[model samples]
Target: MTGDVWAVGDAYEVYVGRWSRRVAPLFVGWLGVGAGRRWLDAGCGTGALTSAILAAGPADVVGVDPSRGFLRSALDTARVAGDAAALPLRDGVFDAVVSGLALNFVPDPARAVAEFARVAAPGAVVAAYVWDYAGGMQMMRHFWDVAADPEHDESRRFPICQEGPLREAWAAAGLTEVATRSIEIPTVFASFDDYWTPFLGGQGAAPAYLATLSDDRRRRIREDLRARLPAGEGGEIALTARAWAVRGHKTAG
Candidate 1:
């Protein structure tokens, strides 16, 4: 998930957005957002987390992403096409700021966290969640483990997605009460093809990496994943995805 493809913002609703629903409530719940408060969903891809915030009864919500197409899809709230490191809104206006599955993709997560702290009022909450790329993000782990293709590296893409780095980014940004937890969600596939077909769409890192391979190589990779995945009697494969989530509050003035 580079800055380039994320700029397009199409089909991700079905690919990333669909799967991210599993952890949306968990992240928003950890946020503990209440009603009648303004919220900012930074890097709110396709309104997944934004929708969750709305459901939790926030008075207003604003979603910002670099992708215009994603902003278009995120029709439930105020939308802005912009970068996370630099939001074009006034400072100290929001009651809470949150992002989901986004920090790892941002050009500068530390800067983004500082920005989240910047736009938040004193004592307002700042929270975000990212997939555990090195560990329990099963789909990605499986793909990277089996693919072994040097054309792309997931670690380079998600340097701050783990527990330690996530907490460090928040603390370095001067946020207080910095705390983190792991949120696990189910990733159920109707069949192996249900899970395998999306990788051909060329949206995320796996798909993008697969795009660079020859047709035969891609087919082989697919077959290898099919073999490695454990299927149930009904041909369904159930996997758990774990995302590391962090939350903190801006210091009171």
Candidate 2:
């Protein structure tokens, strides 16, 4: 749990890929991608963003992530296993460069932003989004409210996951017409168990922290979240997942 959870690889693609589905379309919709254009999906975990981009009718798409396993699972796009700050592709060839729910995890978000701009052609769009972990990301908020470990708080480290930081980062990367917005999607769980089971997978920050707890403590945390969640008809627990998205165009020289 102390080390990087992504080191295990593929576990995130399995669990996170499902969790992110609710918000994926919102992220892509904000992008307003055009048909028959090339795209670079940086930090394209399990192809969620890439798949969304494909559905938007891009002529071609390239999916890149640090996890080879994730790239393996990516849909028909050209997949690259590489770091976000140092993409393996050439510069200014893509019509658009986008990332979803991954900018926070990059070693240097500003550098990643710069890379996104670098790989984009003049007049190309550059966009990215990350979960608003401090407020609207209900699933993680529930887990952290129970766990209450400052060191393990995902929101604390993700400085650029909010609108302000996103705008600033985009500007600093020399992108123009920068704008930001929030996207909220519904996450419905069949039962408390449906929500709790994924925590045991040890994929993201919350699950990794949950994995570190003693069995008794884990039980207490589970009960805490279960008691707090607002269950409705058919024992369903509906929660809102929110992400902060930003977009800008590379300057035409």
Candidate 3:
């Protein structure tokens, strides 16, 4: 399997970042954490969630991700270069720990949940969200369907994006009151170009697969998607994206 390329922030912004930003506030609002708390955004690619937390008036927010390139483009939060599975932060230090649209990418998602639980203060909220690639994330779902590679389809590759797996992971992390919900948002593309150009960015899973294809194959795939996608009179392609969000709390001391 070709490793998902996540280095270029600008390319990522064009790929998934734009849609992820739409999900951030919804995920954060679902968390409903109180203001004036310390927050940690694990796997905080480009600080989407971190920015939302900051807007909610957190006393402090720290965003951590392994990609320095993405971190450089992140908002004004304190950014750290680190992996989610083995966070380089002290234990029980944050009032809230969260990740957004990134949990499925971790090699060991269970271990990353453990790390989220570990870094959270007692009774602190620990949460994360991932794209519902199997069904509701239409942008990628349509791409994968047209791409026709079952092996590389994100829905097959990341089972943890579903509600059951996410709830189970949170509970298995020893987190209390684990709950999950779906957040849906509009992803409107100006035209076929708006929808297809991001695939050429070479950032996420679909784009990475696209990069491996011959020009003829790529062109065929593009035309297939252009025909299959539902477009409006003005060539606007409007789709809905859904993300599964899970939240739980550590047992208070």
Local distance difference test values of all predictions, in order: 0.83, 0.83, 0.92
TM-score winner: 3
Question: Model 2: runs farther than 4 Å from truth?
Answer: 7-14
Model 1 C-alpha lDDT per residue in residues 1-253, reported as the tens digit of each score: 3323653455575566787877888788778867899999998878888777777774698888987767776766688888899999999999999999888778788999999999999999999998888868898888888887443557556779889998999999999999999998888889998888878777767777777789999988889999999899999999888989999999997
Q: What are the per-model numbers of colliding residue pairs?
A: 0, 0, 0
In the range 1-253, model 3's lDDT, one tens digit per residue, is 9789888989999888988888898888888889998999998888778877877775599999999999999988788999999999999999999999889999999999999999999999999999999989999999999999999999999999999999999999999999999999999999999999989999989999999999999999999999999999999999999999999999997
Count: clashes, candidate 3: 0
Model 2, span 21-59: residue lDDT tens = 666777777777778989888988777777777666646
Pairing residues by index, what is the TM-score of model 2?
0.94
TM-score of each: 0.95, 0.94, 0.98
